[model samples]
Target: MSGDHSTYAPRSGFTKWIDTRLPLPRLMHDSFVSYPVPRNLNYAYTFGGILSIMLGLQMLTGIVLAMHYVASTDQAFTSVEFIMRDVNYGWLLRYLHANGASFFFLAVYLHIARGLYYGSYKAPRELLWILGVVILFLMMGTAFMGYVLPWGQMSFWGATVITGFFSAFPAVGDWIQRLLIGGFAVGQPTLNRFYSLHYLLPFMIAGVVILHIWALHVTGQTNPTGVDIRKKTDTIPFTPYATIKDALGMSVFFLVFAYFVFYMPNYLGHADNYIEANSLKTPAEIVPEWYFLPFYAMLRAITFNLGPINSKLGGVLTMFASILVLFVVPWLDTSKVRSAVYRPVYKVCFWLFIVDCLLLGWCGSQPPQGAIVLTAQLGTLYYFGFFLIIMPLLGLVEKPRRLPNSITEAVLSRRQTSAGRPAGATAAPEDRG
Candidate 1:
């Protein structure tokens, strides 16, 4: 699916001259306009484009908020208040930026789940998947730092608690923690550094997004049928089909984002974050944002220590391993089939994994005690076990149903069935060929 290298014919003298110097327009035309997309692709494919729009929205709103935000520990909380009351439309900008982070993560999770279902990470698309994981890591870092910029009770204590994770390291633990916060605790230095990094990392994510799209163009897209394009009829030009679909997806996504920003701006945020920072007072229960909850639950689930390793270090390792496990997922599933649509057993396990994640998230939001702790422990076990044992074993044991011969065939069959004809009915000579 590597791009066709055919030169673009300039339509005018201006474009001809520009093309001679730099062919950026031609590159765009080839990459997005004339690119071939599988005709059988479903709505799940739109999340990638929606994620791109969300990234742009986040950067725009973040820049505006940064203009009014103060990073100093002394003025940070008061400055946020000032922006809400004094700066023009500042509340709107702040809400958009805050809620945008949640929406961004929501879209990314959907995108990842879609990829897993369709096997988008297999074979030629491995680099594309790796780039996406890198983007996710960068987004997590950027969001963590941005949360600290508000200097609210949750922001300050959250920073301290998260940075303290580095202390789980052996001899260098203290030094690592100090390096992260710039002192023994979260203070002016920590705020300034987080602000700087929060501002810088989005552009880095944008740079990686370019590589991800390039990789996508090289491998093309995996369709619902999980079959490679074998003929011209199997695909449609990206311009009219995919571009229009992406535009519609973006519109729907913004409607949901606007609902959160306008109706319940603080719905996704913790109540504790509304209060100014007080080092002497810790919140009754410390919790990260909803997006980080599953991993947070994993971190707190470990209560016992192995020889020379305490529970704190074990929990930290367990949390990090949950994400790192995804890096090797392409190699773990040994099935020749791509889409889970034909793999009955894998589909059931996939939904179970999703439920386990949701359960872990709920456990993370609660205090680590009683039945919740036990539930989280079990959820965390399934989380790791699904990736490590279930995926590999299922691939070898599950028998996938026969796949459609091609994307065109799949689409034709669906159309025929919708028209009340049997899927196996005779097709036109051209379609059959």
Candidate 2:
């Protein structure tokens, strides 16, 4: 599970002494500095850096915006408006933070898709992938809490509907709901706690992300071939090499983000958010934000009530279990080959998973009746089947392509035969820095 290179921990006193001036410039001399990387990393790998940038942007804008806004459920919506109208730069900050969320999800989905496509979640970096999942779940919870702060109709009702789902458990579900809400309903207290957590959880995610990278450094990144790059020639120092590549990737990603911010800031947003919350008159349809739709749809798919258990509790467990199923993926997929490219059966099934996700997203936005319900149920079934049946089956049936003798051989082969580039094509020019 460990990478070939030992980590660069701080050395002893004399080493630390000379380190400050001469520095462990050797640190940069390692993988990233002049490190050669996969010349064909593709767009998916760009996401980790893109997500990091977006998290920073959201944090900065959010802190400034928070200064103008009140957290009280009563004053929350109005204070937001005050910031929009009265506070300088409030509109800019709000839009950036909100749109940053949409972009964050966009990048994360692509990142995850890339992992699926390239088999980035295989044995060597499985923990990094799991850490990414942890970050993703926290992002969701953070986004949910932030969404409620606007105190708009969708925000208020979304909280009510989502929190109310907890009561679907058997005997103790109702009590859990009460504990979550501090009462039978989602109201002022729920708003306060959610807001507090919303503000706090990003830091927690950052801490985990640090661990994620620590894990990444330990195992190194898995490429499309899932080959371990062990030879010294296979890696470049992480500084200039990874730094430049990451920068280029980030720049390309920001262009997409900029277009969203400048041309259509509200394109991804629901129009209902403009309306103030009305506790008495509910909106006919109460869909959550697009990012939450797939799982939201999953929660609504269970219609048959369990004996003495509410359908809502059924939905709640189904919701959590949907993600819980993912935690078992490493074990669930028993394929010897890591990359789906070499595993034809797994490749097709992985695409099926993508299709199911898209279908679930569509179902989430529509009424939970008739065709929508049927579609959700089917999609939900396939979602589980991909993990439970398809992945495990493919491991037994699929014959993998011959693997390269080493990671360097694999990278070299692709460079020469496929890309028409030299073996060390990704290496920097002399003045690259």
Best by TM-score: 1
lDDT of 2 by residue, 103-189 (tens): 899888988888877777778777888888899889999999899999899998998888787776667878987887677777888
1-433 in candidate 1: lDDT tens per residue?
Answer: 3336343578999998998898888888888888888988888999999998889989998888888888998899999999999999989888988999999999999999999888888887888999999999999999999998888999988998999999998999999999989998889989999999999999999999999999898888999888888998999989899999989888888898899999999999999998999999998988999999999999999998988889999999998899998888888878889999988998898899999999999999999999988999999999988889988898898999999998888889888778855443566667656
Stretches of candidate 1 above 4 Å error?
A: 1-7, 421-433
Clashes of each: 0, 15
Q: Against the unseen true structure, what C-alpha lDDT does each candidate score?
A: 0.90, 0.80
- Residue 123 lDDT in candidate 2: 86
Give candidate 2's total backbone clashes.
15
lDDT of 1: 0.90
Give the C-alpha lDDT of model 2.
0.80
